[model samples]
Target: MEKRLSHVDDNNTPAMVNVSTKQTTLRTAKARSIIAVNDEILALIENGDIQSKKGPVFHTAIIAGTMGAKKAGDLIPLCHPIGMESCDISIEVIESKIVIYCTCSVTAKTGIEMEALTGASVAALTIYDMCKALSHNIVIEETRLISKTGGKKDYYHE
Candidate 1:
Protein backbone atom coordinates (compact mmCIF):
# COMPACT_ATOMS: atom_id res chain seq x y z
CA MET A 1 0.00 0.00 0.00
CA GLU A 2 1.06 3.54 -0.65
CA LYS A 3 2.18 5.74 2.24
CA ARG A 4 -0.79 7.37 3.95
CA LEU A 5 0.85 10.71 4.56
CA SER A 6 2.90 13.26 2.61
CA HIS A 7 4.91 16.37 3.68
CA VAL A 8 7.09 14.20 5.84
CA ASP A 9 10.38 12.42 5.42
CA ASP A 10 11.38 9.03 6.86
CA ASN A 11 12.26 10.86 10.06
CA ASN A 12 8.73 12.28 10.23
CA THR A 13 9.81 15.89 10.26
CA PRO A 14 7.30 18.31 8.83
CA ALA A 15 8.12 19.49 5.32
CA MET A 16 6.34 20.90 2.32
CA VAL A 17 6.61 19.09 -0.99
CA ASN A 18 8.85 20.87 -3.43
CA VAL A 19 6.54 21.37 -6.38
CA SER A 20 8.65 24.21 -7.75
CA THR A 21 10.38 21.77 -10.08
CA LYS A 22 7.09 20.32 -11.28
CA GLN A 23 5.50 21.47 -14.50
CA THR A 24 2.59 23.91 -14.39
CA THR A 25 -0.46 22.13 -15.75
CA LEU A 26 -4.17 22.51 -15.89
CA ARG A 27 -5.21 20.78 -12.67
CA THR A 28 -8.79 19.98 -11.78
CA ALA A 29 -10.59 18.03 -9.08
CA LYS A 30 -14.13 17.18 -8.11
CA ALA A 31 -15.39 16.33 -4.62
CA ARG A 32 -18.70 15.43 -3.08
CA SER A 33 -20.51 15.73 0.25
CA ILE A 34 -23.86 14.58 1.64
CA ILE A 35 -25.93 16.42 4.25
CA ALA A 36 -28.93 14.63 5.69
CA VAL A 37 -31.95 16.62 6.79
CA ASN A 38 -35.11 15.79 8.72
CA ASP A 39 -38.56 15.31 7.22
CA GLU A 40 -39.76 18.82 8.06
CA ILE A 41 -36.72 20.44 6.45
CA LEU A 42 -37.11 18.20 3.40
CA ALA A 43 -40.73 19.26 3.10
CA LEU A 44 -39.75 22.91 3.32
CA ILE A 45 -37.25 22.37 0.54
CA GLU A 46 -39.80 20.60 -1.66
CA ASN A 47 -42.45 23.24 -1.15
CA GLY A 48 -39.91 26.04 -1.81
CA ASP A 49 -40.63 27.46 1.63
CA ILE A 50 -36.92 27.38 2.44
CA GLN A 51 -36.58 30.69 0.65
CA SER A 52 -39.24 32.43 2.70
CA LYS A 53 -36.96 32.94 5.72
CA LYS A 54 -33.70 33.21 3.78
CA GLY A 55 -32.67 33.40 0.17
CA PRO A 56 -32.04 30.30 -1.91
CA VAL A 57 -30.19 27.63 0.07
CA PHE A 58 -28.38 26.11 -2.90
CA HIS A 59 -27.32 29.47 -4.21
CA THR A 60 -25.88 30.51 -0.86
CA ALA A 61 -24.07 27.21 -0.60
CA ILE A 62 -22.54 27.66 -4.05
CA ILE A 63 -21.11 31.03 -3.13
CA ALA A 64 -19.86 29.74 0.20
CA GLY A 65 -18.28 26.75 -1.50
CA THR A 66 -16.38 28.95 -3.90
CA MET A 67 -15.13 31.12 -1.08
CA GLY A 68 -14.18 28.06 0.94
CA ALA A 69 -12.22 26.65 -1.99
CA LYS A 70 -10.11 29.78 -2.16
CA LYS A 71 -9.39 29.64 1.56
CA ALA A 72 -8.75 25.93 1.97
CA GLY A 73 -5.10 26.45 2.71
CA ASP A 74 -5.91 28.91 5.45
CA LEU A 75 -8.35 26.57 7.15
CA ILE A 76 -6.32 23.38 6.90
CA PRO A 77 -2.83 22.97 8.23
CA LEU A 78 -0.06 21.78 5.87
CA CYS A 79 -2.07 22.68 2.77
CA HIS A 80 -0.16 24.64 0.17
CA PRO A 81 -1.66 27.98 -0.69
CA ILE A 82 -2.81 28.07 -4.29
CA GLY A 83 -4.60 30.46 -6.55
CA MET A 84 -7.51 28.81 -8.34
CA GLU A 85 -8.81 29.87 -11.72
CA SER A 86 -12.29 28.58 -11.24
CA CYS A 87 -14.46 27.05 -8.55
CA ASP A 88 -17.96 25.74 -9.15
CA ILE A 89 -20.40 24.14 -6.72
CA SER A 90 -23.62 22.28 -7.41
CA ILE A 91 -26.19 21.17 -4.85
CA GLU A 92 -29.11 18.82 -5.29
CA VAL A 93 -31.63 17.07 -3.12
CA ILE A 94 -31.42 13.30 -3.34
CA GLU A 95 -34.15 11.61 -1.30
CA SER A 96 -33.77 13.19 2.17
CA LYS A 97 -30.22 14.35 1.77
CA ILE A 98 -28.60 17.30 0.08
CA VAL A 99 -25.76 16.28 -2.19
CA ILE A 100 -23.04 18.82 -2.82
CA TYR A 101 -20.49 18.60 -5.59
CA CYS A 102 -17.58 20.97 -5.94
CA THR A 103 -15.14 21.29 -8.82
CA CYS A 104 -12.00 23.42 -8.67
CA SER A 105 -9.50 24.11 -11.42
CA VAL A 106 -6.21 25.91 -11.65
CA THR A 107 -3.10 26.25 -13.76
CA ALA A 108 -0.38 25.52 -11.27
CA LYS A 109 2.31 23.07 -10.26
CA THR A 110 0.07 21.43 -7.64
CA GLY A 111 -3.39 19.91 -7.92
CA ILE A 112 -6.56 21.48 -6.47
CA GLU A 113 -7.99 18.37 -4.87
CA MET A 114 -7.86 19.84 -1.37
CA GLU A 115 -9.65 22.97 -2.59
CA ALA A 116 -12.41 20.92 -4.12
CA LEU A 117 -12.82 18.82 -1.01
CA THR A 118 -12.86 21.86 1.24
CA GLY A 119 -15.49 23.52 -0.93
CA ALA A 120 -17.87 20.60 -0.68
CA SER A 121 -17.31 20.20 3.05
CA VAL A 122 -17.95 23.84 3.84
CA ALA A 123 -21.04 23.89 1.67
CA ALA A 124 -22.46 20.97 3.57
CA LEU A 125 -21.66 22.67 6.86
CA THR A 126 -23.43 25.80 5.66
CA ILE A 127 -26.54 23.80 4.89
CA TYR A 128 -26.53 22.30 8.34
CA ASP A 129 -25.99 25.70 9.92
CA MET A 130 -28.92 27.20 8.02
CA CYS A 131 -31.32 24.43 8.92
CA LYS A 132 -30.20 23.68 12.46
CA ALA A 133 -32.97 25.79 13.89
CA LEU A 134 -35.57 23.54 12.30
CA SER A 135 -33.95 20.37 13.58
CA HIS A 136 -30.63 19.36 15.11
CA ASN A 137 -30.75 15.92 13.54
CA ILE A 138 -28.91 17.13 10.45
CA VAL A 139 -25.76 15.28 9.61
CA ILE A 140 -22.84 15.96 7.29
CA GLU A 141 -21.40 12.74 6.01
CA GLU A 142 -19.25 11.09 3.35
CA THR A 143 -17.03 13.74 1.86
CA ARG A 144 -14.65 12.39 -0.78
CA LEU A 145 -12.85 13.19 -3.95
CA ILE A 146 -14.86 11.97 -6.93
CA SER A 147 -12.09 12.60 -9.44
CA LYS A 148 -8.79 14.39 -9.98
CA THR A 149 -6.82 15.26 -13.11
CA GLY A 150 -3.19 16.37 -13.22
CA GLY A 151 -0.14 15.44 -11.17
CA LYS A 152 1.67 12.23 -12.19
CA LYS A 153 -1.57 10.23 -12.44
CA ASP A 154 -5.25 10.97 -13.00
CA TYR A 155 -8.22 9.41 -11.19
CA TYR A 156 -11.89 9.15 -12.07
CA HIS A 157 -15.00 7.57 -10.61
CA GLU A 158 -15.99 4.31 -12.27
Candidate 2:
Protein backbone atom coordinates (compact mmCIF):
# COMPACT_ATOMS: atom_id res chain seq x y z
CA MET A 1 0.00 0.00 0.00
CA GLU A 2 1.10 3.55 -0.68
CA LYS A 3 2.18 5.62 2.30
CA ARG A 4 -0.07 8.46 3.42
CA LEU A 5 0.57 11.51 5.54
CA SER A 6 -0.20 10.84 9.18
CA HIS A 7 -0.63 14.48 10.18
CA VAL A 8 -3.58 15.14 7.92
CA ASP A 9 -7.27 14.39 8.07
CA ASP A 10 -9.72 13.26 5.38
CA ASN A 11 -10.57 16.91 4.84
CA ASN A 12 -6.87 17.55 4.14
CA THR A 13 -6.51 19.80 7.14
CA PRO A 14 -3.40 19.56 9.30
CA ALA A 15 -4.11 17.71 12.53
CA MET A 16 -2.26 15.99 15.32
CA VAL A 17 -2.23 12.24 15.22
CA ASN A 18 -4.31 10.41 17.78
CA VAL A 19 -2.02 7.80 19.26
CA SER A 20 -4.10 7.02 22.34
CA THR A 21 -5.29 3.73 20.90
CA LYS A 22 -1.76 2.59 20.09
CA GLN A 23 0.16 0.48 22.54
CA THR A 24 2.82 2.19 24.59
CA THR A 25 6.21 0.82 23.72
CA LEU A 26 9.87 1.60 24.06
CA ARG A 27 10.80 4.06 21.33
CA THR A 28 14.29 5.35 20.60
CA ALA A 29 15.80 7.47 17.87
CA LYS A 30 19.31 8.55 16.97
CA ALA A 31 20.26 11.53 14.84
CA ARG A 32 23.49 13.11 13.63
CA SER A 33 24.74 16.55 12.65
CA ILE A 34 28.13 17.42 11.20
CA ILE A 35 29.99 20.69 11.59
CA ALA A 36 32.89 21.44 9.31
CA VAL A 37 35.50 23.81 10.66
CA ASN A 38 38.70 25.28 9.30
CA ASP A 39 42.06 24.07 10.52
CA GLU A 40 42.68 27.21 12.60
CA ILE A 41 39.60 26.68 14.77
CA LEU A 42 40.19 22.94 14.95
CA ALA A 43 43.61 23.66 16.43
CA LEU A 44 42.01 25.77 19.20
CA ILE A 45 39.76 22.95 20.28
CA GLU A 46 41.43 20.66 22.80
CA ASN A 47 39.92 17.23 23.32
CA GLY A 48 36.27 17.24 22.17
CA ASP A 49 35.51 20.81 23.21
CA ILE A 50 36.42 24.39 22.50
CA GLN A 51 36.49 26.83 25.40
CA SER A 52 35.16 30.21 24.41
CA LYS A 53 34.40 33.38 26.36
CA LYS A 54 30.82 32.17 26.70
CA GLY A 55 31.72 28.70 27.97
CA PRO A 56 33.00 25.30 26.94
CA VAL A 57 31.55 24.80 23.47
CA PHE A 58 30.73 21.13 23.28
CA HIS A 59 29.59 20.93 26.91
CA THR A 60 27.13 23.76 26.46
CA ALA A 61 25.90 22.23 23.23
CA ILE A 62 25.24 18.94 24.98
CA ILE A 63 23.06 20.65 27.57
CA ALA A 64 21.25 22.61 24.89
CA GLY A 65 20.65 19.41 22.90
CA THR A 66 19.07 17.66 25.86
CA MET A 67 16.81 20.62 26.51
CA GLY A 68 15.88 20.78 22.84
CA ALA A 69 14.91 17.12 22.82
CA LYS A 70 12.63 17.52 25.81
CA LYS A 71 10.99 20.60 24.32
CA ALA A 72 10.65 19.29 20.80
CA GLY A 73 6.85 19.43 20.94
CA ASP A 74 6.97 23.09 21.89
CA LEU A 75 9.20 23.93 18.93
CA ILE A 76 7.25 21.87 16.38
CA PRO A 77 3.51 22.19 15.82
CA LEU A 78 1.25 19.12 16.03
CA CYS A 79 3.81 17.18 18.05
CA HIS A 80 2.55 15.44 21.15
CA PRO A 81 4.19 16.69 24.36
CA ILE A 82 6.05 13.83 25.96
CA GLY A 83 8.39 13.27 28.89
CA MET A 84 11.38 11.54 27.41
CA GLU A 85 13.03 8.84 29.47
CA SER A 86 16.48 9.69 28.15
CA CYS A 87 18.20 12.24 25.97
CA ASP A 88 21.87 11.81 25.18
CA ILE A 89 24.24 14.01 23.22
CA SER A 90 27.79 13.19 22.18
CA ILE A 91 30.36 15.16 20.27
CA GLU A 92 33.58 14.06 18.61
CA VAL A 93 36.09 15.80 16.41
CA ILE A 94 37.69 14.03 13.47
CA GLU A 95 40.15 15.89 11.29
CA SER A 96 38.56 19.30 10.58
CA LYS A 97 35.00 18.28 11.43
CA ILE A 98 32.91 17.79 14.51
CA VAL A 99 30.19 15.13 14.59
CA ILE A 100 27.29 15.46 16.99
CA TYR A 101 25.02 12.58 17.86
CA CYS A 102 21.74 12.81 19.71
CA THR A 103 19.81 9.82 20.95
CA CYS A 104 16.39 10.09 22.58
CA SER A 105 14.42 7.36 24.28
CA VAL A 106 10.83 7.26 25.44
CA THR A 107 8.15 4.78 26.26
CA ALA A 108 5.15 6.30 24.55
CA LYS A 109 2.49 5.74 21.95
CA THR A 110 4.38 7.85 19.41
CA GLY A 111 7.92 7.71 18.06
CA ILE A 112 10.69 10.05 19.26
CA GLU A 113 12.38 10.65 15.92
CA MET A 114 11.46 14.34 15.91
CA GLU A 115 13.00 14.83 19.30
CA ALA A 116 16.23 13.21 18.24
CA LEU A 117 16.41 15.24 15.06
CA THR A 118 15.68 18.45 16.91
CA GLY A 119 18.35 17.72 19.48
CA ALA A 120 21.04 17.14 16.87
CA SER A 121 20.07 20.24 14.90
CA VAL A 122 20.03 22.42 17.98
CA ALA A 123 23.40 21.12 19.08
CA ALA A 124 24.91 21.88 15.69
CA LEU A 125 23.46 25.37 15.79
CA THR A 126 24.85 25.92 19.25
CA ILE A 127 28.30 24.93 18.08
CA TYR A 128 28.09 27.39 15.23
CA ASP A 129 26.89 30.11 17.53
CA MET A 130 29.81 29.68 19.93
CA CYS A 131 32.45 29.62 17.23
CA LYS A 132 31.12 32.12 14.71
CA ALA A 133 33.48 34.81 15.92
CA LEU A 134 36.52 32.72 15.10
CA SER A 135 35.48 32.19 11.50
CA HIS A 136 32.39 32.23 9.34
CA ASN A 137 33.73 29.33 7.28
CA ILE A 138 32.07 26.83 9.62
CA VAL A 139 29.29 24.89 8.03
CA ILE A 140 26.51 22.95 9.67
CA GLU A 141 25.87 20.01 7.39
CA GLU A 142 23.86 16.80 7.19
CA THR A 143 21.26 16.89 9.91
CA ARG A 144 19.65 13.44 9.54
CA LEU A 145 18.09 10.60 11.39
CA ILE A 146 20.55 7.77 11.88
CA SER A 147 18.20 5.19 13.36
CA LYS A 148 14.81 4.75 14.97
CA THR A 149 13.26 1.82 16.84
CA GLY A 150 9.74 0.86 17.97
CA GLY A 151 6.37 2.33 16.86
CA LYS A 152 4.77 0.56 13.85
CA LYS A 153 8.20 -0.17 12.46
CA ASP A 154 11.94 0.44 12.85
CA TYR A 155 14.27 2.37 10.51
CA TYR A 156 18.01 2.60 9.97
CA HIS A 157 19.99 4.48 7.40
CA GLU A 158 22.40 2.20 5.55
Candidate 3:
Protein backbone atom coordinates (compact mmCIF):
# COMPACT_ATOMS: atom_id res chain seq x y z
CA MET A 1 0.00 0.00 0.00
CA GLU A 2 1.07 3.55 -0.71
CA LYS A 3 1.39 6.08 2.07
CA ARG A 4 -0.34 9.44 1.79
CA LEU A 5 -1.42 12.38 3.90
CA SER A 6 -3.88 11.03 6.45
CA HIS A 7 -5.70 14.34 6.86
CA VAL A 8 -6.61 14.81 3.23
CA ASP A 9 -9.47 13.12 1.45
CA ASP A 10 -9.55 11.59 -2.02
CA ASN A 11 -11.05 14.84 -3.34
CA ASN A 12 -8.13 16.81 -1.89
CA THR A 13 -10.19 18.38 0.84
CA PRO A 14 -8.65 18.62 4.27
CA ALA A 15 -10.30 16.40 6.84
CA MET A 16 -9.67 15.00 10.24
CA VAL A 17 -8.39 11.42 10.25
CA ASN A 18 -11.10 9.01 11.25
CA VAL A 19 -9.55 7.32 14.23
CA SER A 20 -12.71 5.52 15.33
CA THR A 21 -11.67 2.37 13.48
CA LYS A 22 -8.20 2.35 14.99
CA GLN A 23 -7.45 0.22 18.01
CA THR A 24 -7.30 1.89 21.39
CA THR A 25 -3.89 1.59 22.93
CA LEU A 26 -1.54 3.29 25.32
CA ARG A 27 0.25 5.80 23.15
CA THR A 28 3.10 8.09 24.19
CA ALA A 29 5.31 10.71 22.59
CA LYS A 30 8.29 12.77 23.63
CA ALA A 31 9.36 16.06 22.09
CA ARG A 32 12.22 18.51 22.61
CA SER A 33 12.81 22.24 22.18
CA ILE A 34 15.95 24.33 22.58
CA ILE A 35 16.14 28.01 23.38
CA ALA A 36 19.32 30.01 23.16
CA VAL A 37 19.86 32.97 25.45
CA ASN A 38 22.56 35.57 25.72
CA ASP A 39 24.85 36.09 28.67
CA GLU A 40 22.57 38.78 30.19
CA ILE A 41 19.70 36.33 30.60
CA LEU A 42 22.05 33.58 31.74
CA ALA A 43 23.37 35.81 34.47
CA LEU A 44 19.90 35.97 36.04
CA ILE A 45 19.60 32.22 36.28
CA GLU A 46 20.00 31.44 39.97
CA ASN A 47 19.09 27.78 39.98
CA GLY A 48 17.13 25.53 37.62
CA ASP A 49 14.77 28.45 36.84
CA ILE A 50 14.80 32.12 36.04
CA GLN A 51 12.90 34.78 37.94
CA SER A 52 11.05 37.04 35.58
CA LYS A 53 8.60 39.87 36.16
CA LYS A 54 5.83 37.54 35.00
CA GLY A 55 6.84 35.27 37.87
CA PRO A 56 8.96 32.13 38.01
CA VAL A 57 9.91 31.56 34.37
CA PHE A 58 10.17 27.80 34.43
CA HIS A 59 7.16 27.35 36.67
CA THR A 60 4.93 29.43 34.45
CA ALA A 61 6.31 27.62 31.43
CA ILE A 62 5.51 24.27 33.00
CA ILE A 63 1.86 25.24 33.44
CA ALA A 64 1.63 26.77 29.99
CA GLY A 65 3.28 23.77 28.33
CA THR A 66 0.91 21.34 29.99
CA MET A 67 -2.02 23.46 28.89
CA GLY A 68 -0.67 23.59 25.39
CA ALA A 69 -0.44 19.81 25.23
CA LYS A 70 -4.04 19.47 26.42
CA LYS A 71 -5.19 22.05 23.89
CA ALA A 72 -3.23 20.95 20.81
CA GLY A 73 -6.38 19.46 19.30
CA ASP A 74 -8.12 22.80 19.56
CA LEU A 75 -5.16 24.71 18.16
CA ILE A 76 -4.31 22.47 15.22
CA PRO A 77 -6.86 21.82 12.51
CA LEU A 78 -7.64 18.20 11.54
CA CYS A 79 -6.11 16.88 14.75
CA HIS A 80 -8.14 14.53 16.89
CA PRO A 81 -9.20 15.71 20.34
CA ILE A 82 -7.65 13.32 22.81
CA GLY A 83 -8.10 12.82 26.51
CA MET A 84 -4.47 12.71 27.43
CA GLU A 85 -3.37 10.69 30.44
CA SER A 86 -0.41 12.80 31.41
CA CYS A 87 1.84 15.61 30.26
CA ASP A 88 5.26 16.32 31.74
CA ILE A 89 7.50 19.28 30.97
CA SER A 90 11.09 19.46 32.10
CA ILE A 91 13.55 22.30 31.55
CA GLU A 92 17.27 22.57 32.02
CA VAL A 93 19.97 25.10 31.31
CA ILE A 94 23.10 23.83 29.55
CA GLU A 95 25.69 26.38 28.54
CA SER A 96 23.85 29.18 26.76
CA LYS A 97 20.97 26.96 25.70
CA ILE A 98 17.85 26.04 27.59
CA VAL A 99 16.58 22.58 26.75
CA ILE A 100 12.94 21.63 27.20
CA TYR A 101 11.38 18.18 27.04
CA CYS A 102 7.71 17.40 26.93
CA THR A 103 6.40 13.86 27.30
CA CYS A 104 2.73 13.15 26.72
CA SER A 105 0.75 9.93 27.09
CA VAL A 106 -2.71 8.93 26.09
CA THR A 107 -4.72 5.71 25.82
CA ALA A 108 -6.73 6.31 22.74
CA LYS A 109 -7.25 5.29 19.14
CA THR A 110 -4.70 7.82 17.90
CA GLY A 111 -1.21 8.72 19.03
CA ILE A 112 -0.20 11.83 21.00
CA GLU A 113 2.74 13.12 18.98
CA MET A 114 1.09 16.47 18.33
CA GLU A 115 0.42 16.97 22.00
CA ALA A 116 4.05 16.40 22.84
CA LEU A 117 5.27 18.69 20.10
CA THR A 118 2.87 21.45 21.05
CA GLY A 119 3.89 21.17 24.68
CA ALA A 120 7.57 21.57 23.95
CA SER A 121 7.00 24.36 21.48
CA VAL A 122 4.84 26.31 23.92
CA ALA A 123 7.33 25.91 26.73
CA ALA A 124 10.11 27.25 24.57
CA LEU A 125 7.95 30.17 23.51
CA THR A 126 7.04 30.84 27.09
CA ILE A 127 10.68 31.02 28.03
CA TYR A 128 11.30 33.50 25.27
CA ASP A 129 8.33 35.60 26.26
CA MET A 130 9.44 35.76 29.85
CA CYS A 131 13.02 36.65 29.06
CA LYS A 132 12.62 38.94 26.06
CA ALA A 133 12.68 42.06 28.18
CA LEU A 134 16.27 41.48 29.17
CA SER A 135 17.43 41.04 25.58
CA HIS A 136 15.76 40.65 22.21
CA ASN A 137 18.40 38.19 21.05
CA ILE A 138 16.71 35.17 22.63
CA VAL A 139 15.95 32.50 20.09
CA ILE A 140 13.95 29.33 20.05
CA GLU A 141 16.45 27.17 18.24
CA GLU A 142 14.45 24.01 17.38
CA THR A 143 11.42 21.96 18.19
CA ARG A 144 11.03 18.31 17.16
CA LEU A 145 9.62 15.01 18.21
CA ILE A 146 12.14 12.84 20.02
CA SER A 147 10.12 9.62 20.03
CA LYS A 148 6.66 8.16 19.70
CA THR A 149 5.14 4.73 20.41
CA GLY A 150 1.95 2.62 20.23
CA GLY A 151 0.84 3.38 16.70
CA LYS A 152 1.41 1.67 13.35
CA LYS A 153 5.08 2.00 14.24
CA ASP A 154 7.46 3.63 16.72
CA TYR A 155 10.17 6.21 16.14
CA TYR A 156 13.23 7.59 17.90
CA HIS A 157 15.50 10.44 16.93
CA GLU A 158 19.27 10.10 16.85
Give the per-residue lDDT digits (tens) of candidate 3, residues 90-140.
999989999999999999999999999999999989989999889999989
Backbone collision tally, model 2: 0
lDDT of 1 by residue, 1-158 (tens): 68646788678988778788999999999999998888988888744326636677777778888899999989878788998999989888888888999999999999999999999998888787778888899989789999999888999987
Ranking by TM-score: 3, 2, 1
Candidates 1 and 2, the one with greater lDDT: 2
**For every model shown, what is its TM-score relative to the native structure?**
0.91, 0.97, 0.98
Provide the overall lDDT of each model, using Cα atoms, as 2-decimal numbers. Answer: 0.87, 0.94, 0.94
lDDT of 3 at 70: 95
Candidate 2, pairs of clashing residues: none
TM-score of 3: 0.98
lDDT per residue for candidate 2 within 6-54, as digits (tens), equals: 9999899999999989999999999999999999889888776788999
lDDT of 2 at 53: 99
